[model samples]
Target: MRFTTIGAAIVDIVVARVRPVLGAKQDVDHIGLYAGGGAVNAALNMAALGGEVSIHACVGRDLEGGLIRDLLQRHHVRADIPDHTLPTGKSVVMVDESGAARAYAQRGASAWVGEQGFQGLDQADVVYVTGLSLKSQAWLEQALSSMETPTFRLVVTPGARQLSHPQALEGLWKRADLLCVNASEAARLCDESVPDADAVSVEAAESLARKLVRRPGQHVLVTLGAAGAVFFDGAQECFHAARPVTAVSTIGAGDAFASTFVHAWALGDSAQNALARATDSAAGIVQVIPANRAGLLRKL
Candidate 1:
């Protein structure tokens, strides 16, 4: 299927084996730079899974921008990056020995894409909007208006960005063909009876999915890391349990799961097959570095 991922593209700086502290220093195991961003990772994941994907985002006219373009091009994802004077957005990620990571982000060019960036958003079979890109209500409106005809499936994953302004994205719950959120985001969107964000269980997933607008071509998929994922439409719910694995880096697991599920579903796989594809794809990604799915999820 033709897939278009809309949002940010960032250069990620990762330092290994460092215990983050305010005033103290720790030994670093390793350091590296990689291409990342919600849009960047999701688009690359689709391309890796054999989907015709394109990325519509913004980047700076700097060295990191060149790296972003090259990385996207290498994976055969058409890169539609708007040029900006600001340095490309970047994230400084610190990882410990146990594979957990903390990141500090600079929006830079990513937050400046604005409405003009939505031009390349059309002509795709599936359009996925990174909720992290909701810096402009106008951009979201442009995206919503594009769905007036319903020619393509609109998938929204409105991470923490939506949580901060739940009212602004209320329209998305109605328009998005599929809504994918982690357990915490779901818990915040529900009424008082829902499970707590800390307790990300099937009950929480189900509760959050039920609160979503019931419309044609609607679905809610909630990812719970090792707890697996839950899929709920209006009628029933399906849960997929995760397989255990030692994680190398948890960075791109969600992107892998989201894109793989969309790819498999677009290929006419049954829901069970799609869920399995997503779960296995996520499991495989955490066992390696470099979130590119070519070596990680392609052969799966």
Candidate 2:
């Protein structure tokens, strides 16, 4: 199947195991520059998994933007995104010894991507979009209003930042066939009374899923880091448990899972089977520090 990926591309600077000291320069360890962004990662994952994938990821006309283009080419994912005046988007990710990470995101060129970025996507059987790209009103509107084959699927994986834009959320999510997000993102979309306020339990996560479906029609998939994921098949829900593994880095785990799930599902896998495939793909990447397209597909 042919897949079209639309989203953000970034140069990720990851600093491992360090405490941030606001006022002084500190010793930094395990610093590496990597090509990243929700859409970029997911597109690469799909390409590696043997899907014919093409992407239109927005970036700036700077060194970092070139890096994203080279990275996608290395992974064999096609891209034709144009560069705007802003610098390429980036993230400074700081990981503590315990495998927890905090990221300072700069949505530079990423924000500049509008409806035009997705011009050729309507021809694809599966159009996968990430949380980062949905921030643009034009891009989100384009996806919602585009004319495509009846089977064309709009799979959205929105980040927590999207919650701030309620009008955008209603418009995008209401039309999206699939909604993918982490526990924290789900927590933000739900009401304060939802159980497991921390999104630590299956019941609580399903509570949030139930709410998403009341909007006539939609499917929700909530990924709970170590807890695996919860899949809402319309109103019917199921939780796929995660296997034990020492995570090297949780970054991009959700993107990996979302890509694999869409690829498998488009190929006609059952919902349960698709979730299992996604779980396995994510588990492999999380246990390794850096995952390129080849490494990720080889794991699968």
Candidate number of the best lDDT:
1
Taking the tens digit of each residue's C-alpha lDDT, what string does model 2 give over 1-300?
Answer: 999877777777777767756856778667877877877888889988898888876788787788778767888888878878889998888877766677899988876665464566666888787765444755657655765444677787776557666556777777678888767677767745433323468887887787766355678888887878888978699888887778777777778888898899889998899999998998887775554343321111
lDDT of 2 at 92: 86
TM-score of each: 0.90, 0.89
TM-score of decoy 2: 0.89
On residues 1-300, what C-alpha lDDT tens digit does candidate 1 reach at each position?
899987778887777667656666666767777887888888988887888998778899998898888878878999878889889998887777777677899989888655464655558888887745566545767656765565778888775666677787777767788888777677676634445333687886787777865586698888887788888866788888887888777777878888788778767787778999999988887876655553321111
Off by over 4 Å in 2: 19-23, 115-117, 133-135, 146-150, 193-199, 214-217, 291-300
Report every candidate's CA lDDT.
0.76, 0.75
* lDDT of model number 1: 0.76
Clashing pairs in 1: none
